[model samples]
Target chain A: MAILEVKNLSIEFGGLKAVEDFNLSLEKGELIAIIGPNGAGKTTIFNMLTGIYPPSNGTIHLDGENLLGRKPFQFAQAGIARTFQNIRLFSNASVIDNVKMANTADSNENFFESILRTPGMVEKERQLDEHALELLSLFGLEGQADTIAKNLPYGAQRRLEIVRALMLNPKVLLLDEPVAGMITTELDEMAQLVKELREKHGQTIILIEHHMNFVMPIVDRIIVLNFGKTISEGTPAEIQKDPRVIEAYLGGGFHGNA
Target chain B: MKNKLNSILPPVVLVLIYFLIQLLLSKKILNPYHIQILMFACVNIMLTVSLNIVNGFTGQFCIGHAGFMSLGAYGSAIITTMLFGGMKMDPNLRIPVFLLSLLVGGILAAIVGFLIGLPTLKIKGDYLAIVTLAFGEIVRSTLRLIEPIGAARGMIGIPKITNLAWMFFFVMITLYITRNFVYSRYGRASIAIRDNEIAADAMGINTTRYKVIAFVFAAFIAGVAGGLYAHLMTFIQPDSFSFVKSNELLVYLYAGGSGSITGSVLGALVLTIIPEALRFLGNLTNWRIVIYAVILVLIMLYKPSGLFGGKEISFLRINRDSFRKPFNKFNDPKLADKQNS
Candidate 1:
């Protein structure tokens, strides 16, 4: 069975349909990329998946459990975690704090325990700090853990967002433009990291990106979107040969190494 | 042993300070007027620090804190004055009763805070401010219509039972609880909500829940302060907990530094004392407010983050190792070089 299944997903803003009849069936540990131009509604689909926006028509299931109209945090609790296209980090917080904030659902301390700082609560907090530091180190953010998040370079900020998302221990991880503003080296590092996340941790991943080079080499499958509709879905090599995807997004003069 | 010392040291210090103040009172080094100012300062500290939980730490604009305080004041006063007014109770028993009444007041204020927060906290920025402002007016106007608690004319003959010891105890509790909440997971959730609502939500934080928690906790503390205030003044009036009182708390929160607990403490203490100190200039005392206004504006202009700049004093600091480790590593040239490479 698929880890996540979305069928006939649609959303409308007034008279205009933002996303229509979007369908996805992500198997466990499968990696996919949603490629589209700006305003092509790639993010709208992600919004629906994460329950940030309730779809006008859709059925979404995570591990065979229906998740139609839940809140965004509920979606997160149900094990779908996502980073933002615009890098929505906790900017004023320290780097470690930004990651630890995501562990709210996992914490079991009650009001009294927190107020009194009981032994159990103190132990839990220490463990959470250690785990957060471990994740930060994985992303090469251990040294920067104490720094305010906004002070980090753009690439680091993007990675921090991913680290924050990963703290949820989601069954499905969504990376929205994870390597959006990165230079060549940062892009390569991000690609390597995403691949490592999937291969080593078996993390089911979906990402939205415009960079064909970045998306092609890493993602197992590609779904090209145009005007809120899926234009093509296949392996990266098959996607490169799809005439409709080429005409709509890549243009006639474009050539791909794949 | 070190952990045990950390736990025991603060209370010992607080007790010593209390005795020192008592000595000053006995020696006539501090007059009743000075004591009154000090007591008011304690109440203000409670008000400002509690307000900071919502306004400063949580980044929620709550201008109706005095409403919560008023509820606490009235709730506790009714117990002491109307419920047990004529009874000749033991002085020792009265202390417990007074503490119970304050707790009742705090809980009452917390209930109202929860009610207001649930509906209003969903809205952000200026809208929340306006709703809170309206809520304050509603609380005041409603209190005026009620006949039992003196109605519009106000309640009088309330016992002045709040002493330096009691005030000090409550202040310490307020500071300790607030500091704990800020350092706890719950406080981190609130801070995350303040930093970025959308991101915090995505990170599995129930933003509304944390906002309401911060609001309700703040209200509870403000309510306790209100109870202390009523006992101190010995007279109660609906006009006392007006919008102006709420505004005064906001000034303290901002002037002290909104996000820092130390800032709140200092802001309330200094602001409360400055006006009293200026009373020596009897003729110019009225102009002292003008001087106060000037100082506030200067602080706002020169050090906009407040005197502490969202940084706590070492005594108030929790997670000491985390505090020291971050800045040193963050500013290290070798770390920067490593990140670049």
Candidate 2:
């Protein structure tokens, strides 16, 4: 059975349809890439999946649980976590705090428990710190743990975004344009890191990327979208060879019609 | 265990500080005027810290703190005077009863805070600000209409149970609780909501739940402050808790720095003393208010984040070792992160 299944999912803003008939059946530990031009409704799918925009029609199931009516935080609790196209760390907060925030809902200690400094609560807090620090050290953010998030260099901020998402303990991680703007070296490094996440942790990831260089090598399957509909879906080689995918990226010639 | 020792350390230190202040009082080292100023500053600190939870930690602008304070004042004052029916209680039981009444008053204001926060789920930013301002005005007028609580004439002859000792204890409690809240998981969620509502929501943080908690908690503390104020003055009028008073509290919060506990303490204390300190100007008595305005403007312009911004005192944190390497400054977290990352 698929870990995540979306059938006939659609959304409309007034008279215009932003996305329609979005269907997917994603197995556990699958890494799929959703690629498209500027307005192909890729991000829109992520929005609906993360509960930012509820679907106008159809049902979404995460490991057999209906996800239609759940709130955004409920979506996260149900094991769906996502990063934005634009990095959205808690900018005014410390770097560690930004990561630790993902685990807040799961931290069971109450206000009085924390206030009175109960031994068990303090131990729990220590574990949280250790966990956050562990994640930070993995990304070389340990030394910068106490620094303000917004002041970090651009690449670290982007890394912290994904790191924070992972801290959510998600079953299905959504990466929206993870390599939006980076020099070739930085892009390659980020791509390698994401692929490593899947290899080492078996992290199930759905990637949306414009940079084909970043997308082509890492993703196992490529799903192409144009005008809010999936135009092609296949292995990377098949997607590279498909005529419709070519037409979507570069407009087809019309000599015969003329 | 060492941890047990550490846990007890803060309360023990607090008690020691209380006794030290009491010693000064008993020794007659400080004048009565200075004592009055200190007590008033403690009240303002409570108000500032309470307001900071909503305005600073949660990043929601609340202009109706004084309304919650008013409710608290009226609730407790009535409990002692009207509910008790002027019957003299045993002296030994009086303090506890008074404290319980103050708690009841705080709870009453918190109920209203929760109600106001319900609408805030739909409203945001400037609209929330307007809603809170309206709440303050509505509370004021409603008090005026209710003749049982002295109406527009104001209440009088309430017992003056608040003293320097009680003020110090409550103010310290306010500081301890608020500081703990900011550092706790729920408090972190509140800060996350302030940072980015959508992102915080995506991270499984219930933005509304934390927001309302921050609001209600702030209102509860303000209510406590109101109880203290009512006892201190032995009187309270609807006019005292107007929109202007709310703004006055904001001035202290902003001038001291919004998110920092030390900021609230310094802001409330220093700003409280400035007006009286200006009395020394004699003929330029009115300039005291202007000086305050000038100081606020200066703080706003030169240090928009306020004096301390997001930082706090070292010892206030749970981990004593967090600030151990202050002297070397070699591994400055703020500067080094930009270069390393």
Candidate 3:
């Protein structure tokens, strides 16, 4: 059974329809890749799915529950988490703090407890710090955890965004161009990381990548989009051979007419 | 081992120094004028740190801090005066009634914070600033029109109740609570929301909830400071908590650096002393404002982040021998594959 389902989802901004009748689904632990040209409304789908922007119409169901009208934070609480297409780390905060924030809601520490420095607050802070360090270690960033997030190398910053999202312990993780500006070596590293997240963490991931070469090995299923609508959905091999995808790619990159 | 000692040392020294000075003041070691100056410095510390929570940590531009302060001062004063001001039937109820009234005032101010925070949450990018400013103006104007409180004439004969002990106690509590909050997860969320709201929300943080919480808490502290001011001065007026007072609080926060608790305390202490220290300028009294304005502008231009920027900068360095051990044994590129893939 699908862990996430999107049916007839459409979003319009005034006179222009950014996404039209979009549909897709993911079974538990599936690693699906979304490939599109710029303006294919790929990020818009991620945005709508995350509730940053409400869809004009259609239903989003997660774990058999309707997800329409929920705020982004509410969507997160309901087990959906995502990283931005752009790096949005708290530039002044320490690297560990950037991720620790994601785990705040699960924490027992509150205003009163923290002010008094109760034994409970101390233990909670220690637990959170340990988990944050472990997450940083998973990304090979333990050394950089004490460093300000903005000072890290570009690739490390991207990895930090993922670790921060993992702080939410989400059921489904959305990566919006996770390896967008990295070099070939960095992309390779990220591709492997995305694979492990699914294999070891049992996280269902929907990755939007313009870098087709990066997605080829990691994706189990591939969905092709053009001009705000899904043009095709299939196994990675089938998507690679689809003639319509070729025409769509030729007519316009991912930004072409649906 | 040294880290724990380092944190504890400053507060112990500060407390000892404060009482030493207080004892000296009682014995007329320092002039009464200087004692008065010291008391005001403590009050300024309360105001600056409280405002930091809203403007600095939460990243909200709140220019109406003085309004909340005034509301607290007037609320507490009015309650105390009506219940125990000798004009009332019971002169015996003075001290306890005044203390209780101050708490009441703080709660009212917090309610005001919540009310203002809710409507302005959706408004940002200068609109929020204007809303806060307008709220301040509205409060002052309303206070002026209230004849029962003597309107433009101001309220007087409110017996002095806040003294050295109460002022320092509140100051310590405010600083302690604020410092703790800043180091907690909620505090981090507040800063994260400030840094990037969309990103914070996506991480499952309730951005609106945190923002409102910071604003209301700041308001409560500001209110307490206000209550203290009313009792300390033994007088109150609409004009006392005006836009100028708000700007003064801003100056303290900005000069201290919005990044850390230490900045607020240091900023408050230094700025409080500046005006009096410059009193030697004699006829150039008006130039004191000019000097302050210049210093603040220079700081902003050279270091847009502020004096401390945000966190405590530890000048202490790690021993070279301590680096012999690797920082992390578990960090491996292989781990990324285990987690990300």
Which residue pairs in model 1 clash with each other? Answer: none
Runs in model 2 lying further than 4 Å from the true structure: A250-258, B1-29, B83-85, B318-341
Q: In the order shown, what is each candidate's alpha-carbon RMSD?
A: 3.4, 4.6, 4.8
DockQ of candidate 3 compared with the true complex? 0.51
Off by over 4 Å in 1: A255-258, B1-8, B320-341
Interface RMSD of each: 3.3, 3.8, 5.7
Cα error of candidate 2 at position B314, Å: 1.2
Poorest 10 consecutive residues of model 1 chain B by lDDT?
B320-329
lDDT of 1 by residue, B71-126 (tens): 99999999998656787777778878888999999999999999999998987666
List, residue by residue over A1-258, the lDDT tens digit for candidate 1.
Answer: 999999989899997988888899999999999987788899999898888999999899999999987999999999999999998888888898899999998898998899887878877877787788779877889878778899999999999999999999999999999988788899899999999999998999999988788889888999888888988899999988889988899886466421
| TM-score: model 3 vs. ground truth | 0.91
**Where does model 1 sit among the CAPRI classes?**
medium
Show pairs that collide, candidate 2.
none
lDDT of 2 by residue, B158-265 (tens): 888898889988987888788778878877898898889889999999888888888889999999999999888888999999998999999889888888878888
| lDDT of candidate 2 over A179-227, digit per residue (tens) | 7777789888898889888988899999998887777878889888898
Best by TM-score: 1
Model 3 residue B101 lDDT score: 81
TM-score of each: 0.94, 0.92, 0.91
